[model samples]
Target chain A: MSDAEERKRAYRLAPCPAYDIEGTESWLEDMAEKGLVLSGDGFFAGVACFWKTEPRQLRYRLEAAPEGTGLWSGNGGLPAEEAVEINEAYGWKYVANRGQFHIYCTDDPSAREMHTDPDIQALALNIANKRARANMITALIYFMIFPLIHLRGGVLLTAVHMGSGLMLGGLLLVLIALGRTVARVLHLRRLRKRLSAGEAPHRKNWRRRALYHRRSRPIFIGLTIIWLGFFFQGWSNENLGGNIMPLEEFTGQIPFATLADMVPAGERAGVILFNPWIFQG
Target chain B: MPRKALSGLTESMFYVLMALCRQPMCGIEVADFVDTKTQGEVRIGPATLYTILGKFEREKYIEVIEVSGRRRTYSITAAGLGAYAREIRRLQRCLDDAASEESQLGRESRE
Candidate 1:
């Protein structure tokens, strides 16, 4: 590639492994070693931007911010100015933050660890743990509310109104979100317990997990899209009673057995009409 | 949820209070003081140091004396002094109890 092309190609984007702190740190370090340095931006949107350059070793650390402070929407928040300055003094440069985690990196090989004390690091993680617990509660409430209010007549009746495909897709999505929330809560709890016991977080091979997520996400999203397509198709089709038409003007076979089907050929049969969209009180 | 009150001092917390006994200090200065006081035995990470500082300030145990840019200098409050003194007395009692127990055990062994 030409120089300009190479410069243009220098910028690259990758999916971030959310809530996997050690994995993320190792992933970023690996990227740095491969000459793709994190560009200190876009981590909040569950993606990281990197710039291609000469390969070098770098150490990345994540600091968990206390809940309800900077992350109102889980995007674009830096740690406190004082905290950043103190760490900066110790050779750790403040980088972009994703959710509650403030990312920092240093090129100094001898720079002191961002958290030298495991007990203190565990104390720091308590903030993230609180947020995870809150998220789990919220997800649980959502999971409960969906069935209580909407599925009054049972799943089949609700499914009839909102097409079975849409209903199933919606339920699956809610379940997936709830499952993720539960998993995060459990993971944070386990990690906090380990930290409380004075154990530090250990690095893992992030490539395998990252690649798995990258492959699975598309399949999950594609299935959701297909189900939504089914819903819209069913919603617009006249045969499903989505559209209204006069019985005399209707030439197609009636969906259900009507009064006309039981009457003799010469006798007249009364047609009772009701709106399919409206519920009769 | 009910917030847990800071009742007793951990080793890090005690050392931090000890560091502030002399004069007001910033975050890095406080860490250095604790390190030197403990002869490098106790090293406070940046996060731990700040968290303690923030919590202490919140509970009126410490107060910010000066703020310049990103550096905050903190001085121990009267409440902070009381807490530190209480912690010291508690440690003294613990040591005295251990000494007494050890002496009694030594006598029994000799007997």
Candidate 2:
């Protein structure tokens, strides 16, 4: 692959959690001079994409974020257009948004940093946390609903016996995501407190090292392949089911004397018959 | 957190207000002026200046006098002047209190 194409390929699978916005901003700046300008990121889709651009160092910063307005409505608290206008006046051009966080970049050699005061930065982070927690709550509900309804209504004994790797994988995803979300929320609250108390935010030491974009692509591709397999399996089972009770086999000449006589009567023995979607005569 | 008013302005805030009091200036100009005024001791980052400018304008401490493309020239309002004066008084009080306390210590030591 060409250098730009290789960077583009690497860009699609990288994810930086919301709690590490500053770290991700620094990472983006580092990536930008290498010709991969951060064009977009999907907090909901869990990926970040970059655009091939000329090689020039640019500073990246996260700005006014929506409380919890999903990816499409990154409108956060301040309207994006207005935010852009205001920020542009300050020399920071709006790049794109991730979740509710608005990203900006500037190439001005003398451009002032977008975030100067630690206290304001801390407050912005706290606001972002509130939105993140809201999103997490929704995601948590979805995780619970999926297992409770589709995964045999939370019957662990039955689910375990079924032995579906997909089920186990989904559950693991939910657990890991939940743990990470909860941890982030707690950390944000603490950091917010320290910032409010006038102490400089000292969180870099505890931050998770940014996952290399190039390294994560294969893992992401593997997950996508597994998901497609599950989807096809479901589609096949629905449309190409094995059991079929042909209508041609049961002729109108066959008459039942009575409903009770047709079916064997002895405590109404229930025969579990297979049902199929498409029947062929 | 509640917005900090005139009583508790930081060094950067004080210098920014001081810079605006002299003349209308854009963010870049203000930063440069402050750097010159403080002799490189107090350096205001561009990002920090951008934030402070927005805030000062919002609080009516400063008013935009002119906008030329991305550059905006801001002049201190009456309120900003008052804030600067109050901050100066606060520092003066601290110095006066320190000087008196030192004199008392000297007398006590002599006795």
Best by TM-score: 1
Clashing residue pairs found in predicted model 2: A66-A76, A112-B46, A112-B47, A113-B47
User: After superposition, which runs of candidate 2 have C-alpha atoms over 4 Å from their true positions?
Assistant: A1-12, A15-18, A40-46, A64-66, A69-82, A146-169, A186-281, B1-111
| TM-score per candidate | 0.76, 0.54
lDDT string, candidate 2, A32-120, tens digits: 77877776443335567777777778877766463344535434433334345556766788767665566778898786656555655
lDDT of 1 by residue, B3-103 (tens): 78787777888888888889999999998898788898887777778778877887788999899988899999999999999999999999999999999
Residue B24 alpha-carbon offset, candidate 1, angstroms? 3.8
lDDT of each: 0.74, 0.64
True contacts kept of each: 0.70, 0.24
lDDT of 2 by residue, B1-55 (tens): 7855534676778889999888888777787788798897777754456556666
DockQ of each: 0.66, 0.20
Residue A258, candidate 2: Cα error in Å is: 20
Model 2 clash number: 4
